[model samples]
Target: MKYIALFRGINVGGNRKVDMKQLRTLFESLGFSQVSTYINSGNILFESELDTKSVLMKIQNCFHNTFDFEIPTIVKTENEMKKIAKSIPEEWQNDPTQRTDVAYLFPEADSKKIIEELPLKIEFLEIRYIKGAIFWNIKRENVNKSQLAKLISHKLYKSMTIRNVNTARFLAGEKE
Candidate 1:
């Protein structure tokens, strides 16, 4: 299976630094082939015979052993990533007018009917939930006024690994 491992909170603010070359080596050491990293935010794409759960467990175990920190990871199949990217409207690009993001939720996180659960009462905030992630778009000018702006402080934020729409497109093989 081809898997994309979205690791959370790594290589941020010069902390939890993980070199792309070393990260590739780490994945390769676990018998995964075609391992490659994108943009150094711990997005690893690779092939393995094991299922998604098995791959996640192996990576987490070896990752902590090698790096000495537990990485909160969400593993998605290539098709799933593509679906996530496809679900977003074409107009929801991050630009001067609006910002779009995909919050890839952890497996243990309760994502079902998340749109109704999330605090999206603001008029400028647009939110949608599929199986594995939440797609949100907010007007840039109104972001500060919207409850979505405080997602970082929200409880659901703890269970998510967010990426911009462009990153989501790239991960889905829909872009450069």
Candidate 2:
């Protein structure tokens, strides 16, 4: 199976620095094939026969052992990513006036419960959920008014790893 592992909070603000080269090496060392990293934010694309659950377990253990730190990792199969990318409207993007984000939720928390918890301000938000993730958008100017913008302080935030639409598209193989 092919999987994309999105590591949260790494290489941010000079904290938890992860070198992509070493990351690739680490994934490769796990016996995964075609291990490759996307950007410096810790998105890794790799293939393995192991199931997604098994893959996540192996990567989490290996990552902590190799990097000496623990960070939440969200894994999605290539098919799942493709569906997510396809679900996104063509117009939503991370640009001058609009911002789109897909929050890949951890297994324990990927549910309608979190979606229900969102106090969405329709004027500033557009949100939807399908299985493992939630897609949301907010006008850049009204970002502060969007519940998603303040999600960082919400307890449910810890259960998700967010990516901008651009990153999501690239990972889903929608961008070259």
Q: Say which candidate scores most in lDDT.
A: 2
Report every candidate's CA lDDT.
0.87, 0.88
lDDT tens readout by residue for model 1, 11-60: 98998888989989999999999999999897999999999989988988
Quote each prediction's TM-score. Answer: 0.93, 0.93
TM-score of 2: 0.93
The window of 10 residues in a row where model 1 has the poorest summed lDDT is 108-117
Which residue pairs clash in candidate 2? none
- How many backbone clashes are present in model 2? 0
lDDT of 2 by residue, 1-176 (tens): 88999999899999999899988998898999999999999899999999988999998888777777788898899999999889999999988999999999888888877777866676668888888899988888888776555688888888888889999999999998
For model 1, the local distance difference test gives 0.87
lDDT of 1 at 75: 90
